[model samples]
Target: MEGVMALMRPMPVSPKQGVTSPRTSVRRSTPCISTDFSKRNGCLIRAQQLDSTEASTTVPPPVSDSKDNALQLKEWEVGKLQEKVAASQGITIRRRPPTGPPQHYVGPFEFRIQSEGNTPRNILEEIIWHKDVELAQWKERKPLVSLKKALDVAPPTRDFIGALRAAQQRTGLPGLIAEVKKASPSRGVLREDFNPVEIAKAYEKGGAACLSVLTDEKFFQGSYENLAAIRDAGIKCPLLCKEFIVEAWQLFYARTKGADAVLLIASVLTDLDIKYMTKICKILGLAALVEVHTEREMDRVLGIEGIQLVGINNRDLETFTVDISNTRNLLDARRTKIIREKGIIVVGESGLFTPADIAYVQDAGVEAVLVGESLIKQPDPAEGIAKLFGKDISI
Candidate 1:
């Protein structure tokens, strides 16, 4: 059908090559569209194929007018550009993989939404795809280059790592990195009457060493404004910007918004990305909490450069499965030795609900713990912190 063919035409190569700027008209070979009818001695002749040589050699026509072609071509170019960015950072997972035959049926409209007739296979994969689309829109509003000027006026970074070590020594317990979360995709809304700044103040009064503020607005019902509000409210505990960062630009943006540190998930980032981004964080004076869910992820991060704070997540972000033992398992004797020798501060994350849970991870070698659900749901979050540690940890 013409509709189907129009939607699935082979796209032009990138305009960066100077064949034609995306704003200008694209020149392409037009295919012959005809149907043949002939009477040969009272017998009708069948329609013949178009010139086989031309079909083989000729490039297809522009899918539409200059505007439509430019828009479509720009989308393709952006995908390729992101691919190059990821590849340069040693990442193999592409935002959108190439689909269909190389020279034909090059459009990915159907494949993107209906791959194998299924939605994204896992939550992490689904989140990454969503982030790709979201990042495109965000870049249109606040391009990365524009954020550099904002970075210059950003608030000074705090000693996130040093605070945790000091708290651990002072309390003789794992330092609490209290979370200010409204909701999560796994457990839905944890608190309907959530006030982020109020919760942050409670956590601080309850003796939290640091605060992890969820800045993702979609799945977590959180916002960067919360981080700013907490900072302005004079909560002295250093704030960690908890966001799904897919590019280096977000680090500078987080600093501008009053983050003392930023979380980096090892499962989502390649080793090279961690290394490169860690350098960027150091340059910006923002501490990076490199998070891992398994031994493989842990091992990969340990090999990276300038990784000071490592958080072992007990919940698998992909399947949403919780196993508090994950922290203990990954922190085996060998890994523990390496982590200690390297001066890497391990922060146990997720599924920690009680004093026993706190004690479990502490014995497993975590100097700090990032906890949310159990503490946030209590009638008084400050009391919840006391319950979490079985004593007051506030200074």
Candidate 2:
């Protein structure tokens, strides 16, 4: 019994031997004792607790990601609101296709499937949608700040309205605003030879009051380069930058590129947009040729103050169909009376191929005519202009 008691005595431990005082605590460096079940269980429990703590404390996403998502949501909401406003004003065309779900999640494959929400309803709508994307890319290349700076050295603007009025008074007929068109969506290519400067000079010599240069490249195969080239070539006729003016930035861009006037389609823009854009045009010394197709569109444009030039586009832009009677239908007695009172110069656009066609629109009260395909298709655009007016108006 003495030997067994002596063997069972507790051994003394030094500070370096991994023993802690009763008042202090120290983590164990070695693995849990396998022979001791309690120690093994405690080690497993502590490990699990540490893992639970780490799992509860998750890392947050970057701040920029959250901000970008918020911005996109706001833009989407604003777009929907704008569509509603346009619908209220009887605009059937949408500025862009409706937004859909994330492309990756919508279909089985990586690409998005074609649907009504993502597809354009008509040619006009398709053009507008494409224009929006193209404008975004252009804005990135030439920001508004740079465009504003460019305005300082831009060419002086001519009096587009005065030119038309003078031409009509001198010729005793509707003034001609000849078009420098390369190709149209409906008609593939107007002139295979397609020299913009040459065409502009011919039109000027033929007594064209102003020139319309189609500046849309995707559909029309026209460009700002053509307008600049024509202006640099010393053509006297005022040039109309025939563009789908969606934003105000385009007005500044047009002005810098030697555009004396710009086309503002009433069907594409709202009443408020027309008013605002007209004001901008006034500040920039650029004329606004607000074109209308339907009676409602004409009324909308007529109601806006300070509109000097109103164009009646006889072609249905949505359907690519032409009917000269559209100009006659929109400009009735009451509208004509209002137009005369306001001192507005009415221009009949599209589908005028003959002298009878010009006379019909003039009888309906248009002071000018915008003829493109008929004139540009002929071997001599100048002679085409004479034939269109039924006389040598240049004399």
Candidate 2's displacement at residue 100, Å, is 4.5
Position 24, candidate 1: lDDT: 36
Q: Per-candidate TM vs. native?
A: 0.76, 0.82
The RMSD of every model to the true structure, in order and in angstroms, is 12.8, 24.5
Each prediction's whole-model lDDT (CA): 0.75, 0.79
lDDT of 2 by residue, 130-241 (tens): 7888899999999877887888899999999999988999999998899999999888988899999999999988889999999999889999999999999999899999
> How well does model 1 score by local distance difference test?
0.75
Model 1 lDDT tens row, 176-226: 999999999889999999999899999989999999999887779999899
What's the lDDT of the predicted structure labeled candidate 2? Answer: 0.79
Cα error, candidate 1, residue 279 (Å): 0.8
Candidate 2 colliding pairs: none
